[model samples]
Target: DQQVKQNSPSLSVQEGRISILNCDYTNSMFDYFLWYKKYPAEGPTFLISISSIKDKNEDGRFTVFLNKSAKHLSLHIVPSQPGDSAVYFCAASGYTNAGKSTFGDGTTLTVKP
Candidate 1:
């Protein structure tokens, strides 16, 4: 079964606006939630992450929020730029998984200027 899922396959936002991407997981074993951004041919780059113990984590213009009770997580990008347009993948990992992560299909974010 697919443990992690990104309900919305695509999202469009205006430049300088906020882009919010969402993910959900059915596995309770996941203790760490991570967000990754990928361009066409490049490997996915780590964006932001949060632990199940915390509700939120922020770095620069990117922020990640986790709601363990709902098995939900979200990534928010403020003042989204054209460069921010890419496929964002949500991944989850736990100690039991040996650092291997379960990734969602990914959400394509398009930031229009």
Candidate 2:
């Protein structure tokens, strides 16, 4: 049914702390995974991505880990900052979809001062 799920609707953390977001998928064929960050009234910006062939990908303060056996993935933001307050969406693409991504409902992250 091509459903990507983000169990938590929102998350909050204090500045300089680590923020973790989780996602799950029912479709087993999704091979390309990506994370996007969105600010209010703006389109989502690509943050990081991981191919199913790999288990983890990291960029600066952001990291994404995939567990193929479990059909689960998670995003980690280190030292979360006030500027990081926004919505995060997990997306997936695969051979069946010709690289078109399907998105999760999204998780809103708030960083407290």
Candidate 3:
């Protein structure tokens, strides 16, 4: 069974709206959660991240929330722009696992202009 999963294959939103992507994980060892955004032909870029010790982390227009009790996490993009259209992936890893992560398939977000 997959350790991490993003149920929504895709999402569409109007410009300046909020887009929320959800992720669920089955592993309890995950202590760090990360969100990455990827564009065609480009490597995934790190967005925001949250530690199991904190409930949320935000950077500019992006925000990541984690719920350890539920083994779930969500990413929120406020004022979503067309340029934000891309595939978002949720990743989980332990402190000792540093560079290694258990990643969700990915959620494609289409932000219309």
Give the count of colliding residue pairs in each prediction: 0, 0, 0
| 50: Cα error in model 3, Å | 0.8
| Regions of model 1 farther than 4 Å from truth | 96-98
Model 2 over residues 50-111: C-alpha lDDT tens digits? 99889999899999999999999999999899999999999988956634998999999999
Preferred candidate (lDDT higher): 1 or 2: 1
The total number of steric clashes, by the backbone 3 Å criterion, in model 2 comes to 0
Model 1 agreement with the true structure over 50-103: per-residue lDDT tens digits: 888899999999999998899999999998999999999999999556359999
lDDT of each: 0.94, 0.93, 0.94
lDDT for residue 72 in candidate 3, whole number 0-100? 91
What is the alpha-carbon lDDT of model 1 when measured against the actual structure? 0.94
lDDT of 2 at 24: 97
Give the CA lDDT, 0 to 100, for residue 41 in model 2: 95
What is candidate 3's TM-score against the reference? 0.97
**Which residue pairs in candidate 2 collide?**
none
Off by over 4 Å in 3: none
Candidate 2: give its CA RMSD in angstroms: 1.5
